[model samples]
Target: MSQLRRILVDAFETEVALRRVFLWLPAAAGAGVVSYMAADREPSLWLLVPLTAAFAGLAFLARGRRLAFFLLCGLCAFFAGDLSAAWRSARVAAPIIDRTTIGVVEGFIEQMDFRRAGARFVLRVHAIEGLAAAATPYRVRLSIHRAPPFEAGAYVRLKARLLPPAHASLPGGYDFAKDAWFARIGGVGNALGRIETAAPPAPPGLALRTMMALDRGRNALARRIDQIVGGDAGAIAAAMVTGKRDLLSDAAKDVIREAGIFHIITISGVQMTLVAAIFFVGFRRLLALSPTLALRYPIKKWSAALAMAGAVFYDVATGSRVGTERALFMTLIMLGAVLLDRQALTMRNLAFAALIVILTEPESIMGASFQLSFAAVAALVAVYEARMAAAAADREDGLILRARAVEGERLRLFWRACKNLLARGPGGLLFATFCATAATASFMAYNFHELSPYVLIGNPLTLTVIEVFAVPGALIGTLLYPLGLDAWVWRYVGLGIDGIMWAAAEIGRLPGATLHLPAFAPWSIIFLTLAMLCSVLWRTAVFRAMALPLAVIGVWGALCGPSFDMAVAPNGEAAAFRGQDGRLAVIASRPSLFASEQWLRADADGRPAREAVKKDACDKVGCVGYLADGRSLSLVFDKAAFAEDCGRADIIVTPLFAPAGCAAGLVIDRDELKETGAITLLFTASGVARRAARTPDEDRPWSPAPRRKWGPSSRPFAASRPTRAASSDLDPSSVARAAGEAPGSVEDEDGDASPLE
Candidate 1:
């Protein structure tokens, strides 16, 4: 307790800049709260407005304590701001939910992605036949069979089938709707026929024209790079320079991802910082060559301004993604500090950058890119500041220490040799790599459910090539693009890229190169983040020690065992049942690689899809199988199987309407699955419980409740007469009782049951 108290005192006594950084903490917390609330449920303007005003009033009243009061105000303001942002975002470019219609859609192509199978693009809708103006989606994503000459900003028309953005494929899986909601993508579909070019070629309005021009330039550069360095190498080079990663091969992506160096291809803080450094040094050297200008002006400030300009150019050249926006903002803040003659890389500067990003794009708080980028920066800044402080302390104590510590010449010489060996050679580089790897590994695992065990080896082996050759070569190539002389630079850049790819592939092929992990509960990430913040933000050794236990506890919780025993897809087309060996066996009637991958990744099961498939007694009717616990389950396809398995199987899953008098203890048919979305079943000694992808509380505009309608009833199946022989499975009485139903009785006459009920 005393040690903790001392740590707090030390933190308080730290520099004002350091103290100011902590003020952003509460504001971020508030933004995070609002983001989660908006994700789970609709934001109520009425409730948030009054709540914000009330907090503002309290903060005003507490103004005598200025720091605390301002902090409180920041929290409330950001909270309200985020809620308002979410509400506004939900209404923008609303999705068209009518999926049954196929019509001719005309729109301007805004972006294009070329996958191995085909090409996909996001189109800004101008008109849609057979649909009302208000009902038409603002933007639609279309997948076509082949790549067309349709560049970005080109108007085109095509016959397509449009539907609402996809929901989560499984419970706790990726939320495509949420991502699309923020990205302003309203609908997704496939192109049914050939795409014809529309007349106007370009859109009206100054902003649109400017964007079109920029995109044209980007396309030209990409083509030039492709011509210069053919194959996957050219694709990767183009991606590095222009953020056009669609052409990259899946094998290359896999190698990069497995090696944990995928960030190199993306324009992020590393690329932005490197660009700025290049500009700063180049400008400073050029200015120094002019003696009169160097003497008359503040050359450092001039260089900093030029560096800021360079960062802005790079931001645009790289497609200006959210990550690029963040990098630009931070770069601006650092250069602004130089302009104001203050320290550039201070915690307060980072906090200001974070504050600006959160206030503008509140949804970014939940993104993995935002979280991981900030984590790495925060860790580096904290370590740098602590090291600087320690050095200053050492300088102050040097005189007093020298008199007390006069050592023998031989011992002193030996100590100096050891220090030089550790501090100035490969040891230093290795240590830096270790710190960076450690700082990013946990967050990477949390977001991606995998870790690259060989990153420590991979990064150091490739860092020099990337820093000295690839980035610089790419930058030079981009600068020369206007003159059609980029090929000279690209040739060298391709060589460097080849080296990086080779290193990644070799390291990724090593045994146990990657470690996959299960999905972590939300609170686990929060706990780990808090622990990291405590360890880094505090100044004293005692505070770091205090955080150790918390870090350990968070890690343990994140790595805990899986919760449910079985997961059923929302469509009733597939299910994964856990076996006694703790492996998941997938029973899928149809091939759905997306859902299968999601299940495997979520379970952290490293097995391939072919290996995980369960060979069951499947036929045209359905498949019946026993789980690891001897719980018989029958997947019914048609009436024949339904009648045969209804009374015999412990649980029955069917794609058709539930037949009347069916006696399965638990039945998940099309109706229930459609209403609740995907579900996971938890098998305990007492009974079986279920969890739905969407709950009642998740009643947002994007996730509406399933509609109800009376339909023709299927033929009644007698429960007393079973065609199939009853296997030695768990009794239906125990399962029904655990579900809070009377033995041998259906839970609901309407066949509508709550997710778990």
Candidate 2:
């Protein structure tokens, strides 16, 4: 302890500590935001007051000591993050639909998106037929089957089935409700009937008018591009420029996502940097043409300023998302660094940019886009920095200069120059891609429970086409469109998009291209993130060495985490259980597709739902699922089946309320399911472990506790005498070979496996 204190004191007193102290302040702030987000219950209203006061008091008390002062300042930043998130959450608080409703919805269209299934409209609600004014949400997202006659800002009325924002289906799944809450989106549903135009009761504000105009212009540009390029390629090209991603089919999106090059389609750092570089290079060369004037002026700074302006315009023009805005912020900061004659590509600049983003949207810390984007950038930058340092060292030692001076080495030098080009171009891109993929793999698994193993190949192929063809086409096409000569440019743009799609398809079809894994505890992600931060951000070798063990622990935890034996859907319409063969046995032939898909992903089972439910004995009465331990779990539909199921089965699940006396060891009925939300159970050799999407203890506004209309059974099933409580769970077929079974082999349930009924 004394040695540690001395080390800390010495660190703070040194000049190096000054730089290191500021470098970690943003991370400290993010840690505080994470703390706030991880809370099961909301903190008190005045909690920040005490936190701030404590920080201030500590700072003043240790003002004379630099070490203590630095620690207190970090504490102050932490407090600020927590306070910022709380205030932002409160500011965005809006009414969310509590229950599903079929009503006439009237509103001005705020946005429209094309999807494979239908068009989605974001409505600025004027009214909901059955809901009161005070209860109605300001914004509602609705899926409309056909193209609406009107565009954004056009007032319209439609009959729709609107539902309350939904929570995740199972534990550790994405929380849509939380995202909706932060986005101020109160409800989401499908339009049922015709949409009719209606006059607005009041004129929209000036800001709304400007936003609507921008949307209209984007639509026009997309239409023009579609006319020239055509097909899915054109739609993709437009998406790259105008952000109309809904134009692509879901299959295409899936292919791209699985290939791990989906970032290219989105307006992210790659696109933004490409845009900035175009202007910066073009303007710099243009100014260089006039050498007399260029030598007397700061043309590089002028070019950087112009590039930043272009990037900002592109971000706004493309319908800026959080990801786009983040990329734009980084670009602006990098360019601003150039203008100020400061090094732009350092981690310090990245940290400064991160601070701005964290302060502006603290809630984004919980989002996949924010995490993945920043992680990828940090990894690439760190790798580049290391590479530059090594190259500089070689140059300083005169290794290259000394070798180049030997005339007999000319042929070797020529080959070496070619190799260097390869290294700087494709080889460099490949290495950078690997670094980014490695950095984001944990985050990817955390968010989607999958990893794109072939991303190393896929990204290089797609991104090369993007940087070489698509970006240039977009720039040239947009410029020449006014002159009525962009048609030719778009044709080549379509060719480039075709290359990207072809790569996506081929890579996606590769065996084991995507590895889906079971969800792990949140701590796994935290550990992995910490490991990456320590590895890249620390200046000392001792601190950096800590990353290896942290990474190992994180990987071990993620891969060896407990897998749930069974999962029930949020609405009690579907459920799946792990079979003896280790594959999922969905209980319902006609299960909710979304629920079934999510359940399969959570289990790391890639089979389609129809294939998974084939062996289940499902009928109008109910379905019976066989557990690995030879126990049966019955999903009862008709109450008549309850008598037989409750007597024979170990567990019973039903939408209807269970009878007073159930012989089953466990029962989860409608009321219980409603209160608990979706549930997952892990039946291990020790015992049965249960988890829920939303528990009674979960008090977040996004997932409130349901109003209990009925009480639980008085009888304790555990106290029943006949059914013995035993730890007799069997291992999956992978390990059940000891019990006279072949590896990955088990007898199928002797029942029908027809299809989704």
Candidate 3:
């Protein structure tokens, strides 16, 4: 306790900017968490407005109490802002509830994603054939079996079957609906036939027109690059330049992901920083060629301004995604600091940039891109700051001169050799790559449930080529496009990119390149993140010790084994049970690739859908099998099958109604599944423990409980009695009464489970 106090006192005295930045971070993070948790509910502005005003007033009155009052006010204001933003987004993109109808849909193409099977795109709906304006969704995603000639901002009409955006495939899986809500996508469907052009390119407003122009430019650039280098390498090059990744094949993507260098394809902080640095250095050197300009003008500031403008243009030209926006904001803040003659890479600058991003798009905080990008930057900055401080202290103490004199010319020569070796050789590059990979590994594992061990070797190998040749060549080619001199540059860039791809492929094929990990519980990620923040934010050596225990606990929690024995889909059509060897064995009567992938990924199983399914037995109704624990489980789709399996199986899963006298220890019929959503079961020595997707407390706008309109019917037959069933039929009432209990009722229900479910 005394050590902690001394460390805190030392930090407070030495680091004002770090202290202020840390003070603001928790408030912003708290607001983001609240916004995410309350995503299913509508926020009330009436209450928010007064709360914000009162907090502001209190903050003003308590200005002298800097630590307490300012932090409280910041928290209140950000909380209100986040709540308001989410509410407005929800109100604007209300889901289309009536999903049974199929009709002609007309909209403008906003985004396109090409898949191996075909192409998928998000359409900004302008009209629907039979639905009124108010009833129609603002946007719908459509998948076509064949690639279309359409591009972004093109108006088109097509006959399609539209439904509400999909729910999570399994309990605690990815929430496509929530993501779609933020993206303003209300419906998803598949096109029935060819898409027909509806109208000429006529965007609604100036902003949209500008966006369309940028899209057109990007498409043009992509096509030119593809023509220059026609293959997977070409596709990856185009994505790196224009942020269009749909052209890359799944195999290509997997290779890059396994190599842990996929971030290169995304136009994030690394790309933006490279672009700005290139421009800054190029312009500064060019201006410095003239002594008059160098002496008379603030050439450094001018270079920074130009770099900022270039970064902004690059961001817009590349679709301005959440990651790009965050990078752009951070770049702008740093450049602005340069213009103002202030420190650029301070913790204060990062904090300000974060505040701006959070205020503008609070939902971004929930994304993996945001988390990973910020974590990398914070780690780099902390390391750089510590190095700079140490260097300054060494210079102040005259240690360098004294050492040089004492060691003489031999030592000086050795020092010079080492300096050159580090600066121009692999040593410095390897060190930097190691630091970056180490900093981002935990975040990647937390978000993706996988880590690439080869990143240590692969990133340095590929990234060196990218930084030296590919990025520069691409940027130069882009600049030379208007002059019709881009082809040669693009060819050179393609050669470098091809080299990167080759390196990634070779590295990815090595043994144990990728390691799949089980999903971490939410609290584990929270604790790990806090620990990272503590380690980076504090300067005192003693204070850094605060993160050690928290980090250990977080890692322990994340590495814990899977809790549930079996998982069932929302519709009871698919299920996965863990075998004795801890491998997931899928039993899906009606196979869905998306659901199957989710189940396998969550189970940390790397096998394909067909290979993952261990028990595929089925007879007319549904499948029946024994779990690893020897527990009998059956899925009955037909009445006769239900009657036969009822008493024989310990657990029965059915899409149809269950008989009243069904004697299964646990029964999940369509009715029970409708209310509970997806379910997971853990078979302990005592009994079975169940986890539901949606609980009673989860009754919000996004996940409303199933409405029960009818009263419960009494048992039609006498209890403790059985009736003879026909060979082809089963009496539900008789079965219910014979069991002497309700059909769906089961004892030893466990409601408190992992929040992941």
Candidate 4:
């Protein structure tokens, strides 16, 4: 077993690899970022800053001993990462919109992202009608549904409905508001009617002007590609060249997603590597034609430099997303290695790129893009390194003719070499596919709640087309566009796009193509990540031994964690209760489409929102539903139903105020939810447990406490009716029974202070 493991797991270690201590810096720094994110409250920099500096200085001083130096350096990286995240959070802090508002909006369009059905515009806001100057947001994003989409740098005035950034739909769900805070977006909304262009209050600044000009140029190219392709094929072709996926048809998107080869359209490692490779080889050959010049100067370094420039150009032309930037940085590092005559394709280069990305964008560590990209690369490199060390693989590649061989023997050798080539053709591609898919499956499931079983069929088919024609076509088209001769290039590229789309559609339609998964505990991914790194990074027996157990623990936790019995939206706009069939059935007076969708996906339920509604006893005043554990839940809309619900139900939830002394086992009201944010309840043999999306206990900047109502104060009014029960009228025995405790069973040291039940 150990011998088999050693062959497959790359235990071939070099002294150089073992001594590269900086390889671990990115991991340590990432750990620090995670620690900061998981904290319930903000960290104090004044207390942490000096301590971090001192620890780093200590690491610097411990240079003589290699082991101690590595340990201390790792600690320093961790501390620096934590401090970096905190500092970034503080620096990006800005005013957030408090409530929904409907009015005219005037702003300069900073960005425009078009979709097939609609477009989203990010604006640098100048004013919102009727809002106080202090309350105006610095920026807002609006979904434009009407025609005549505005371009970047255009000033527009339009009426719209704007809302504050929202919290998670349920506990441990994705937090859009937190992401928006980092992006410096204060609000999001939908625009109404046609957009009206207006004169700018002032000219755009030099930096903004430059960026907008570049965006306009790229968008023009994307549009031209779309025009030539003329269908869903065109949309995909445009995306392949420009990374603008908004124009994709729904069918195309579904097929690509199910096929699990959507990364081809995105500006990721594959795209970057192709562009750089083309430029590097093309320029090197071009330079080498002049032997006199080639011998006098370093043509390889010159090629690498041009390759780096080409990569940077591709990155910016394709929107410069965080994932693309990461790819560009890694590509640049590899090219730089060529210049220095060092081994370019190694783990050390990957580590250096990761470290640079972490220090520059610490917040990016939390994003799915960063995690997925890095994970796939790490797995591929590990497998490649392992294969390189195998003796058989070398012997197969070393097959050649000997000078002493006779005619018949030479013929035999030629056929033998042909057989080896045929055997390697499909085997190598399949192996690489397995390695990348296995490494990214858990994270993909965790993020999208779905997996593609046909990726094995899909990746090989689509990737070939992408490599042979699609990428090269885009590259040629982009380079020749300024000459007005690129239309022919795009027409050929469309044929490759058609092939890819056909493969995606057919493979995606196969039975069991997509598998839905329930959301797992967030910490499970951490364990899984550690397992991957341990198995791939080090060639030692001890590290290899640690990998399997950690992976098992992660998979167990992800698959076996407790599920929510019931859930309520943050603002009490939508609520859901789980039925006996283990499916969520929503119950709400004013339903929220976004919240319902999130809940269904998280629960791994594929039913539509309408079909998923709970068929409970309901009327205008209230509704009653039953839990799997035989508990009755009552939702009261009117104050009239509260009196009856508070008495008969196991739990009472209402927007109206319930009178004191209700005998229900639990009471959840609007005021309570306002403080708790969204919450999920878990019912067990012992009792009921609640998990809130955001509790009063946590004080993160993105999730500030609810603000008080604004306006002039009013005098309190007294109710004349005396029929309802008042405060301090509770019956001790009834309340105790509701709490599942005998009345006055326990004694306290002070008789006057029996703990309030």
Candidate 5:
């Protein structure tokens, strides 16, 4: 009895400590690392080294408790893994000669890329031709043009120009550079006519053929389903089945986006959770039915193993990076628990899973999918564990036992079961969704500087449907596969999804479905994360209550923060060509790329909105009038362009290069004025004002001295502060009069007058 007591006490103690570590330590350490990255001027690796040593010491000192030690080690390892991955990426990226023509390119196609011109593929390059001196080979993204009809599995070789990824000139453009970097894609381009099919055999040991075969089958089924459902239904169904959302139409996608159901587009947590639950329930039932099998072996253990196998198959079929990683990590945990004959929900399992994934691919740790997936799982596990602990504590108090007759005990158990179900199911799902959305929003806001206000509603609905559908669909797909009816099954599934799409579209069309919140401040996300952490970690009711207020404050900050669209000068003088909705508006100055493109992609980072606000031909340099969703924002190339039909111009912006006669009313060119010997003035109307220049005899507080050299091409001088029309009509030599002062005055500077040559 004493031995048993000691074992129970040890198990309980270890479990509690492990819980504290996994549930809380990660957030603490993550905070520290992120803080260090932000605050330190000259980052000291030694600071982390000490922390690393301390973690290692903690692991070693906790002798009998292997789980706690492994967790600490895992946390430290993740930190190290992040640094290593970043370092390696930097090293590999540094040596590659930019614009070098000679490099041996080799890699299989990662995925089929559909472009307007033709079907291309994203090739993962292994080598470059001329730069053999560069030891480490980084992956390059190649766009194969005019490919001989190819599917995702096909392998081809192409000699193409490797250019650096494009950067956003303005704030809101998508940073392909960052995305490509994380994806380990170093270059992107089309084939240069020399293309060949180099169908390489699958690698020796890994599950390449099996994975490919599964992918091919899934794709084939999806295509057939697409054919059956046709159009939007087919696209939605294909996405549901194979996790391929690229086929979805803009209208269908917009509906999903507005409904906050875009999470359904990705097969990760929803599918995995359902898969695990089904296996757990089905296997428990099977064991109950068969006493002989139940007595001999642990049915739950076998169920977990089978569940893992299903997850593996599901991941391969989808090939979503996040899904694959999460499924693999979770499966590893289950498999490890099975081998140890331990409960799968322990802190050790989560740690081991995290360690495996980080050690394999550290870059994934930084991605939104990984962060959100782990956050949801962590939140769920923590919530469940807390409930179990509370129940156990209640039992230990004996107050419940003293009051319980047989009927009373039965009622108590029923109530406790109900509580557990509610806590772990609906409550847990909601909390998990909340945490994930918060974290993702924060990350996106910091990176893209924009927030989709509808996500609060969108994600929950989407995740709920996904959770409802993913498992049932996977199971039905598998069951029907053996009976040669999977295709037929998916055909109906496609039809059902199409109906959902219609509903979502209707929802999107409703008034104010998507509220566009400007990019958030950094501290807003930080405080929000803090509030979320407090809610999860704090035990006292008073402390927990604080989380709500903090969350509200954080959200308020996010909603009313500095917009990335506006470029403000250091002195607080700022300008933006912005729509009333706070989106960038059309300007006469350097054509606003994003303004012209009707569809703007909001980056989560607190950066400028660099994507096109409209998808019109206005992406290029030219005057354009954007008409999308019944709203028009016009731009004129000539000086002082007019919008006849539209309402009064909400905001007028002039590029620095706007013709001398052009009047935009507001000019955003602080840098241009600082660099060039020119001063821009903004007034209520088109006008010219002249102030006498300070002479040497007249003392001035702070003034720039006038300097001059002979004109590069001397011409006859025309003296005057030219009117808009005079300036517009002036010869090149005469235009130089205002700067150096000409001999004769020739024109009038009238206020609010139209500048027509």
Candidate 6:
């Protein structure tokens, strides 16, 4: 019987070795799918999938056991990659029924965007009630008519059509629809009134409502905390507790982004891992304190179980998204290991984690968090296992030489222990962190152009602190949680986090802390991913060393390769060039103050253009030119064009309408000039004719004229073309006044200049 069992075990092992090539097939497929989905111009070569699948199947049949296992790994990786696209597509196609009149909407605000004069938000509406398009709620990314003071939880109703969020018009541009879909947000809008008391209907048979309730409660708590502490500290505290970061102003957000410490506010891997580790350590320590209990049962095992419970709670508290999912999977595996009397950090455990993640949320397969966390774990496991195997071989060789020598056995055990410690020690931890950060950063750079230069420094320091502080704090928090003192402990924890926040902000201020790159190309992302995969897989020392540096350089080159920073004006015209400070500027022939302000605010990092102009005029037409400072733009307009002479505008721009003789410069028709994508002006007659439609021809021509005399600088410039000029040089206060006096008008800036200001 024993011999048969051994034979069967050996046979099973052989079968695994033989069939393993198929495992990687999913990974390969996922990768292919991801590539296909992320394609700027989706290829018509989908027929290649079937061919590849057939080829892979043929290869699997031809390969030996080792090759089969390798193939299996590829398959798994392929499937994981496909998850992003599948989830994204599902979200876009599935529309939540938003009952606009019923005042009920379900979904989350995926992100915020820029609006004309206010702000635009994208909501991934899961379900909506009392709306026209409730069958499958298509997305309705709402542009807030006015700037509403709100955050992710600020529920609102909209009296607008639900339109699909904009897609990437150009290749490799940010896809808003996909982003919103992946986030499960269906629409975006402002609050109907103040967030009145309302109950959003629950999704079918899911814990979404319960999770949302907790989120709302946490949001309330964060609001209260924000009120208690002002500035960054307050924002950090609120972020730590409730994960509400929108409470911070735009300036604060920019500061954090620049500093590269913005991740702390988001519920991320650090938070989940910290909380779990603390629970485990604390519970273990408590059990150990009770000597009798410790002696009777394994304390570490109990501690692991207790820690898992805490992780479960944390998952519930946070809504069990990607971060929570990863933590829960990790905690469960750890607890399972303790229960099963096996090693936690093994390849089997990694497989288990993968299975758990996929089973729980198939959508997570393509998520960066899932890929990064698992990849890092897998790498660590493989490396550790290989080292163990090497040590075992060394010990076996020594045992053969020593022939039952006690000294040799003792030495071997000691060396093994040392090797194990070395694998997980501070240096190893730092290396692991660096690798993970690099991996995640690469992935993000591919998806989002924003990459922090400070990560090289920030990640190590921040992770070290998190590693040191998290286990202890989490233990304390979990211990106190049972004793009804969790809140008090977290308060103190908040204090510690505040210190961390201070340090992060300080370090983030260092030079080279931030680097904004142009959006990545799909092919660049593919190449970067390939580089990482190669670095991870190359087993030879020389090959690995060579690969690592090459990969880094390659990724850097890909990131810094090209730029697409074109800014489009509200009128659907593209801005010609970036302003002096590298900002987009727009020149409007008849700039409505509100419209200019909207474009400026959206184009600017979140500041409005009106404040820089120093005026209140929302007259008929306004000319908005880029000021030298990237932060500000000047508005040029005519007072008579509207009705009231509201004294607002950095400078007024007017056409040169010379009646006595022909104007010195070329005359431009505003509409025709706008079409040329240049700064050209309309003739006095044409300008007056167009004005007649709005006002009456009897009313006066709005263009102010100096006739080379007493008024403002009447430079004889043709209104026929666009001209680029320094903001410091041009003033149009007199041109605005001249437009009201007579039929003649004066040109503002030179022709042939871009209307982009």
lDDT of 2 at 122: 79
lDDT of each: 0.69, 0.76, 0.70, 0.74, 0.49, 0.47
**lDDT: the better of candidates 1 and 6:** 1
Candidate 3 residue pairs that clash: 660-732, 660-735, 660-736, 661-735, 661-736
Off by over 4 Å in 6: 1-29, 39-92, 96-163, 192-208, 220-230, 281-306, 347-430, 444-457, 464-491, 542-560, 564-576, 579-757
User: Which wins on TM-score, candidate 1 or candidate 4?
Assistant: 1
lDDT of 2 by residue, 187-239 (tens): 88778888999889999999888778778777777878877887788888888
Quality of model 6 by C-alpha lDDT: 0.47
Each candidate's TM vs. the true structure?
A: 0.85, 0.86, 0.86, 0.84, 0.64, 0.60
Q: Which residue pairs overlap in candidate 1's backbone?
A: none
- Give the lowest summed-lDDT range of ten residues in model 2: 745-754
lDDT of 3: 0.70
lDDT of 1 at 485: 78
Say which candidate scores most in lDDT.
2
The C-alpha stretches of model 3 lying farther than 4 A from their native spots are 1-7, 17-27, 38-43, 70-74, 77-92, 97-100, 200-203, 285-295, 399-426, 482-484, 579-582, 613-625, 632-649, 654-663, 710-729, 732-757
Candidate 6, residues 487-592: lDDT per residue as tens digits? 6545554565666666667866786665545444345655666565545544434334545665666667675543322332212222212456655444544223
Q: State each candidate's clash count.
A: 0, 1, 5, 0, 41, 81
lDDT for each residue of candidate 3 in 1-757, tens digit (9 for 90 to 100): 9996886877766655456445445445545555655554556666666766777788788878867665767766666665556555555555563443478988778766554457777788888788888888878777777878767778898898776555565666665565666666767767887789976445567776677667778877887787788888788778888887767876887888888888867776777888888888999999999999999999999999999999998888888887778778888999999999998887666777777667666766667777777777777777678767855774554556665666555565567557656744677666666666666777788767788987878777666766886678768888899999888887787788888888888888898888988767656766677777777777766566778888888888788734577887766666777776777776756555566666777677666656766555665668876788777878776665666787577777776667755666677776666677677787776666776676544655555656764765211212222443342455655544333312221100010010110
